[model samples]
Target chain A: MKSLARRLVLAVPLLWLLAFFVAPFAIVLKLSLSRAAMARPPYEPVFNLSDGFWGLVESARQFTFDSYSLLLSDWLYLDVYVSSLRIAGLATLIALLIGYPLALAMSRAPAHWRPILIVLAIAPFWTSFLVRVYAWIVILKDEGLLNHALLGMGLIAEPLRIFATEGAVLIGLVYAYLPFTVLPIFNALDKQDSALVEAAMDLGATKTSAFWSVTFPLSLPGLYAGALLMFIPAMGEFVIPDLLGGSNDLMIGRLLWAEFFSNRDWPMASAAAIVLLGLLLAPLLLFERAQSREADT
Target chain B: MPRIGASGFAALLLGFAFLYAPIGLLAIYSFNASKLVTVWGGFSTKWYWALLDNRLLLESLWVSLRVAFASASIATVLGSLAALVLARHGRFRGRTLFGAMIYAPLVMPEIVLGIALLLLFVALGLERGLLSIIIAHATLGMCFVAVLVHVRVKMLDRSLEDAAHDLGAGPFTVFFTITLPLIAPALLAGFLLAFTISLDDFVLASFLSGPGSTTLPMRVYAQVRLGVTPEVNAVSTLLLAFVGLVLLTGAAIAQRMRAV
Candidate 1:
């Protein structure tokens, strides 16, 4: 009876993930290789076991790399891929620059204040992500509050065109991902023994130099983890770019959305998704390694 | 342990200011009487009233709430089981694979998952609608719930359970009487997190939801894409306020659990 209960517990989530999560990837790969059909479901070689072995063979023969080749040969796809990497990279860097300091502050905060700071850091994250991004539209528009404040303060003569630009998307990306970047770094920094920094300082190193030599090196794992957390999602971020980006600022996510929804090309969209997943695997692996390293320490 | 100097403190203040500024402005503007969302004509509650009268928005809001409640419940059950497997049933076969499955969705791109699941639904000949959205959300949200609940489960005292077993209590009885109550806060946190994920989702739900099955975020996204309006601001403010209240309750629960 105990073994039955245990097996039931194990099998439920495992089988569900296999069916809902893992099987979908297999279906996506199959669809990516199949032909785009002008039908209700919009893909060809919809395989079934009713026709038996010959049907399987026939459907298997229809699989091709045409979509992938199109991705390679088309400059539009190439541009979108490059643009996505660039934007995500920039956003990650910006987030790191901003998040590192905030994390440092939180980590050094008094013990009673630490949890409050942590919660505050996580507050914006818990709010509606779409709402947060839309908040940017309210701030970055021509007559938006940001321009109003800047112009009133004599920072600019006229409103700067930030909305619907790559800049706007970058802001949205960094804002959305700031919590992911902050918490890991805070965990790393907070876990560091203060005695080590004191030891470095006592050994004739100045505060800044001691920080550079000892503290920064100890926090490398968290830095990598935080960067990956921000970069990976930002790479395939659909809503931010779709809402904030202008006509020419097409990212891979937006391109995939356009292809699938507007063009109704399922094969091409799946191929894009597959490639996007491929691009993320290395960073994802690095993130896992960083997390494990943090755990070990 | 005063690591931050005066300048560092100032920078920290600026950092938080940067974080909260947009949200602050958004909330303040939600009450703007102007149809032009940016212009501050005066303070009023008309937009809130306007939100009530917007039938499409109201329908989507209802859909979002229903989806959030159902998916969060399912995710909590599935996720609590997965968490048990991870935290309690150690050294099992294929444990690494199980852990990987739980962790992968936390980092995987929504678009990738969105398209993959859409294709899965299409292949399975399932109609895309409320049910599909719930399934997709539960799948995604369970990963988060598992992660959250796993942390609490790991931190749980095993001695109580062992003592219960020694006293002739079965696994089921110990779980219901002791384990469930002990980790109740984390379970609630996981549910709330899943609920928030389901409520806030746009991309995944957009892909799964069929015609006339628009979620609140989807409806808001469609409108916000056209331009910023006071109505979106009003709705967003309400969402922010609601989530804030939920988060505060979660925090209070955590604090109370810790105190005990």
Candidate 2:
């Protein structure tokens, strides 16, 4: 009776995760292999399995790889993949550039101000993300604050087309993900041994050289972590792109959303999503390897 | 980088401005005497007053509060259990898979989870609304809370529990009376962490929320789409205050627990 009750307690969580967490992914996977019957009320998922023994690949289950082929053949999906990569890439670079210096300063600063600055760094996120993004909309509108201030100062005669553009989207994405970049880097930098920097400097290395040789390597764990943190989400982010990207900009997140919602192609949407999930997890696995290597060293 | 040097001070000031200006502008406009957020006429709280009576917005806030509270509590219990189990039973055939699954929600694209759940619910003939939102929020929140509680439980001297068991206590007694009290601080931290995330979630809520179940963020999203009013600022300010209080209470509890 005791063991049975204990098993019941443990089984509750396992069952919960199985039902809600794993079920959704399984549903997606199943939906991907099947076809979408858009004609029905509340579109039914169709998996034809008429062919005995050959049904898995060809006979049934809409065995034609048409959706995958269609998704792959489209130039737009490729564009989305490329654009997501490029935007996430640039955002990661900028975050590193900006975050590195701030983190370095925070690490080296007098201990009194460290916690305050750290809180300040993260406070922006506490405000609703949607609201923050909307604030950007307010700031970057054609006849908005930036232009109003510029026009008042006569910096330009006309309002700038800052909103609903590529630049605006990138700015929003970067702003939102910057803290993720900073926290890890700060943790890494703060824990770095100062003696290493002093030792390099005593050997006549310039401050910059000393930093590159000693401080930077010591903080690689955090650097890699921060980059991975930013890059992973940035690569797949739809919220920022949806809110800020111009009509022409077709990032994969938005593209995937349209596939699932607008196009009603369950198979194609699942294929794209699975591809995305795979792409993200692959790099994460590499990060895990890197972590193990660092531990070994 | 060192003292109150000019360049260092200037850079620091610039960073502060970069962080605050956009948000400060929003707060200011929330009380802006004019319709356009960018336009400054005078100071007024008309928008704040307006939000006081909006039935839809109030209902959404109530729904969000219910979800956040319930999900956070549920996540705490499950996560604490998962933490205890994982820390004790460190390796199994699917340990890495479980770890990955836990971490997945923390970093997975919100859109992916959102649509995935939507499809699952539709297929299962599960209705979309508050219940689905609670389940989804709890899933993500549970992952983070589990990681936290596990670390604390693992770091603890397992001997303490062994000692209790040796002294005639059962495993259940050792867990409840000995283990649980020691890790209470961490449980509090994890719960607060989960609560904040549940409160702030928008994308998942957006997908799962039905006509009567729109959450606070969802409402703010729609309102902002119409146009950001001081009402949003008021709502946001209220949320910020709640976070501040939760964080303060959590820190206080943690410190007291540590002292004990």
Candidate 3:
């Protein structure tokens, strides 16, 4: 009875997840393998639906590799995926470059000031994310603040076209996600054993050397955590590219959005999504190890 | 490390400026007297006053408020239960899998999930509207709550729950009376995060929202897409203030919890 009660406690969440989370994704996965039969409002699938035991129904389709084959054929789709990957990769590296030093400073600050630092790191999140991105549009436009300031300072005679450029998208991506990197790096730094650094110093190692040997390597847990957090989202980012990039047609997310909403190719969208989900599955498996380290202290 | 060189100070100042300039310009231009948003015009509160009379903006904000309040509350309750089970129980069959699934929604791209959920809704003949959006928000916000509550549960001493059970309180009562009070800060944090996400959600709202069911972010996004306006600035300032207030409340809750 006791074990049964405990099982009930566990089963509630488990079943809820299966029904809503796993089942939906499975349906999508199944659909990814099947072709869409373009019918009227109630579009039919090219699959026979038969009731299975346990009150579940399985789709009966002469499963073929056709959807996968169709998805891989177009060089247009491949190019978009590669472009998005490159951008997200660079954005992740840029976030690290900015975030690491900032986190180091925050971690070394007096204990009394730590909360203040944390609040600042989190303050940006409080604002609406879309508004924050929209704010960039105002400042990066040709006659916007950045160009106007440059002009007024006599550095440039004319306004700069900072908006609708790849650089603009990068700036938006970095600015939008800086805090994610900051928090993770800060957490790693906060948990550092100062004693090790002191020992390295006492052994006559220089401060920089000690940081390189003792501090830097030890903080990889948080840094890795942050990179995964930021990079994964950046990979599939739709809003930044859609709003900031003049060349929006070069992103997988944009393509997927177009395929589903604009082209009305449901099977194509599902195939694209399945591929993206496969990309995500790599980091997601790694996230557990990161979480345990984060949760400790 | 405490005192930086001039170059360090300059770099810090530059970073801060980079962070603040965009939003600051938007805030300042909200009060600009001219119709052209980018032009440096005279100062006025015309947009703020105009926003007050905007029926579309007001209606959307009201819809957003109702949805956020409903979704956040539901997510917090269910998420708390899940968190308590995960953090306290520690091990069950498929515990690792369970934990991963709970947080999968956190990292899953909203565009992907929105499309998936839309498909599910379509397949079910469930029309797109407030109901669909609420469930979507709840699914997402539940992850934040679970993570937050899990953190709090990990931090708790835990022996108190055992003591309560030994004193004859059943599992349900022990949870309600003892465990709940201990982890209240996390629960509060979870609710605030959920509420804010639901309030600020745009991408999912755009996908799933029915006609006239647009949320505040959707409203702002639409207005901004048409072009920059002073009304957007005024509305953003209000949003900033409301977010500031919520953060303060969340901080106060954390402090009060720590004190106890």
Q: Which predicted model would earn the best DockQ? A: 1
By TM-score, the best candidate is: 1
Candidate 2: residue B24 Cα off by (Å):
2.6
DockQ of 1: 0.77
Give, for candidate 2 chain A, the lowest lDDT window spanning 10 residues.
A40-49
TM-score (chain B) of candidate 2 = 0.89
User: What do the candidate models score in CA lDDT, each in turn?
Assistant: 0.91, 0.79, 0.80
- Clashing residue pairs, backbone N/CA/C < 3 A, model 3: none
lDDT tens digits by residue: candidate 3, A1-297: 666777776676667667567776876776676666666322335333344442233344444556678777878777877888888889999988888877877777767877977877877876778878888887888877678778888999889887888888889999888888889898888888889998999999998899899899999988998898788888888888888888653676777788878887777777788888888788877876777756674
When 1 and 2 are scored with DockQ, the better candidate is 1
Share of native interface contacts present in candidate 1: 0.78
Put the candidates in TM-score order, highest first.
Answer: 1, 3, 2
Q: Which order, best to worst by DockQ?
A: 1, 3, 2
Model 1 residue pairs with clashes: none
Alpha-carbon lDDT of model 3: 0.80
Clashes of each: 0, 2, 0
Chain A of candidate 1 gets a TM-score of: 0.97
lDDT of 1 by residue, B1-260 (tens): 56567767876798889889899999999998989876789989999998888999999999999999999999999999999999988798899999999998888889889999988988888889999999999999999999989999999889999999999999999999999999898899999999999999999998999987899999998999888888889999999999989888987988898688
Instruction: Put down candidate 2 lDDT per residue, A1-297, tens digits, no spaces.
Output: 656655565576677777777888986776666666656423343433554555544524444456677677888777778888888888899888877777776677677888998988887765567767877877888877888899999999999987778888888887888888888888988877788888899999997898788889889888988888889888888778777778877777888878877887767788788778887887788777766776686
